[model samples]
Target: MIYADKTDLIYSLASTRARIFLARPRRFGKSLLVSTLQSLFSDGLKYFSGLQIEKLWSDRQYDVVRLDFSGLKIFENLEQFERDFKSVLLEAFSPLGFNINKSRENIVFFDQFKSWLLTLPPDSLVLLIDECDTPLTSHLDDDEAFDVIRNHLVKFYTVLKSAERCLRFFFMTGITKFSNTSIFSALNNLTDISLDTKYSQLLGLTEQEISLHFEDYLASAEKVLRLDRNQLQNALRENYDGFCFDRKAQNHIYCPWSVLNFLNNPEEGFLNYWYASGGQPKVLLNYLKKHKLANPFAFDEPRQIRLSELTAAREYKDIGIEALLAQAGYLTIRSVCSNGYAELGYPNKEVELSRAQLYTEELLRGKNLDPMGVPMLSELIETGSLEEIVARFNAGINLIDYQTFPITTEAASRACIQLFLMGAALMPEVEKHTVLGRSDLEVRAGKRHWVFEFKYAAKTKDAAQLLEAGREQMRSRRYGVGPGAGELHRAVLVFCGETRRFERWLEIEDAAD
Candidate 1:
């Protein structure tokens, strides 16, 4: 039944005397966490008998102002964004018989709301602002109006931060941390507990939690899919296990909505749960296209960020990579860096796949090709077969637009080969950015080092010959210019042309292969 996340909620709420700004992606159960806190603060101890909150304090009620703005979807242009945002204050406090009018904007509304909260007895003003970042995220591109909204938010939150004695506790949750000339600049006192291990399992569903809570659904899934529990677990894990808030606690979790989708539609697999929540990849994709940021990929933890740069409005392009992933629910802060560079990466396998898909979707510019290629390519990588991998690369060739510029068939073929190699480099590998012998991309996985080369054909020429020449070049390349020289595991050449693609995979299976 009731999970034990309430402990973290109580602690976070109680620990912060000033304003608190917590950011997590959609479907991470933020609303549920806040609601649980609301109940606890409302002195509903009967609802949480064994929760950690009960042990921390005696049952006491507080005058709470819970502004759950998640339900307000009215966001398109500037006027509506402002209008609806201000309207929420009225709706939230309307129960207090406050006849707030339309002329009162978000800033004024919030000021009045705070004043109302302060009027309550001392230590009675606990303000919870849910989906606080939605309004900002909704108008990411609209710089002019977004500035107003940001100012409104900043001034509103600054009150809570400034008036330490007037406010009991302030908590805000939202998807994606809005950086740059945003409200965070104003609420500088707001502590970001986004990575704290004490609240790591605060959002999302761990595998153990799912199996324990939804055993019936798992059984039903097994019966419908005709799969054993292990297979089902593997499938679920593959789709959703990579997100970890606590690096030591490997089973951090998946969004509860995604799990429910799998249980309800076992045949469809994990169908776009990450995209379903507010579905706004435009900002990320737009930036990617505008500036081709072909980063080999970044996965680590405690991603470093300059607080000043992050809250600047003009530096959207400079947003920290890890912060993006964290806001999008792809990464979590495994550790905090009081000083020095912050390391950030996917928490687990589930987040890895989700991030991969999200990145791929953005790269392809809204193309939704059947990811049958993903599993196929995954198989090729698993087998470590060069030929199979080449074929798969060719299979997905048409999916990529190779005609970025006009060139001879030979040049195109060469580009295609190299392009596929570039794509393959996105796989999990070490020294992931290095090009071996100035030829193929050299990557190390575990103890195995792989050298990959790609060659293509030109129109009006023999495609097969081009491939052979490409293979010869690869041999001449004689890579393994790294630490793992003698310990090389495989060398692969993938050649492509008009007819199809071929691969020449060689592993150190024997001394005379």
Candidate 2:
């Protein structure tokens, strides 16, 4: 694996804060960062070798205690839980020349470890904790067990807090953040750099890192992809980039896991590497599945949230759906305002499309619609006639139980169409942003791309009249003129209130101004 130099940041962050916490989506390289920091602290200078941090870091080594909480299983009883973490402790303590007493309870071993740290000089130990929140995620439905597990974790962390004076550097990482009211209150003075601008690119790969460190991978991909240098970069950006975490929305990064996978197999072109990884927090997915219909356009549009919502970590059940989605990596900071409002939406084409297919499937299961219809939609888009496409769209639209899920707005209607098109392998991006304006839906099928404008006619208008209005909207605004905009056809779809279906659908034949 080609490593990008991020030790400069590690130098600044480690030197400034004694206890730091980083919150990121799974597989975003939190464990890897902890591993690098572990090596730097345990073995000091020689470990970093040629890395940039080698010169910046002081020539100092400490007794490093690295603990990954993901390995701890939550059993039904406190005795079982204590016995479970005992194994993790014994192995981690072996290198330090101490056989931790396995007979003692979980908190006792930690307390004993704290006592041993006191034997050394003050601030002489380094602690690295990874996936610290994994233990409590599985007990969401079991509050008693959740509290038992949480209280036990608080005890373990309290040992670290008591031994703060003996710790030179303490770093922790997890996907979900617990607040002051819960496990966070156990450890005072813990600085959360989850949304800190300076460290937003700390875990994810930056544009500079991708261009500098992975040039050979991109070149190989370019040759196999039959695309020039610029095209390859654009494709990578479209597929796996544009995740912003800071308030300013300044640093856009590529998913570290996705980037590495693409670089390793660039000839495979781009895929939904992140979402397809199947590493989503299961508890979060269950939450979304239940509340998905609350706002169908949540991911399609730029959703706004207060700055405080993101900085403070809440219990899973309390965090608003939008903030939950943002923290889960389904949404990212698109922009921010002066008064502490951050607008968030899908980070890139890959996430947007993957979510579309997911939502469409969920809808099908809820409505008891034929799942086969989705594959048929894909086949029609690739080889069928225009009339066949229209029929398929109408059927998908009608599949929604109008009585249960009322469609009162244009957004609702467009969301419905977008889901179906996305199921058909069309990859429809709703309200796609461009310099000119937002195209209602931009989609691609077998190398044929289109810019679609949707119209809602509540009153008297013939199909031709409604379609002309849509065509005018596309032409006057030039809705499709940006990256990957080579040779696109204009399209219009109209829904009449009287018919409650696609009253008109046509692809206009217009080339020049």
Highest TM-score model number: 2
TM-score of each: 0.67, 0.85
lDDT of 1 by residue, 1-513 (tens): 436344745665675565676666667778887787677676657676766766666646776779976554455666776677667766665765555545766645666666655665666567788987665655565668668777767766665655556566778887656556456776666777665557666777877778877888889888888899999898887666656555233336676767777777877655566655643354454445555553322322235544332223345556655456555665554444556334455655445545555544543445543254355444455454555565565555545544432223433434443333334333433323435446435544445456554444433255446456655655554445455444464444433333444433343333122
Q: Write the per-residue lDDT of candidate 2 for residues 284-367, one digit (tens) a residue.
A: 666765554555534476788997888676866677877777777878899898888998888987778767766776656555
Q: lDDT scores for all predictions?
A: 0.57, 0.75
Task: Give residue 475's error in model 2 in angstroms.
Answer: 9.5
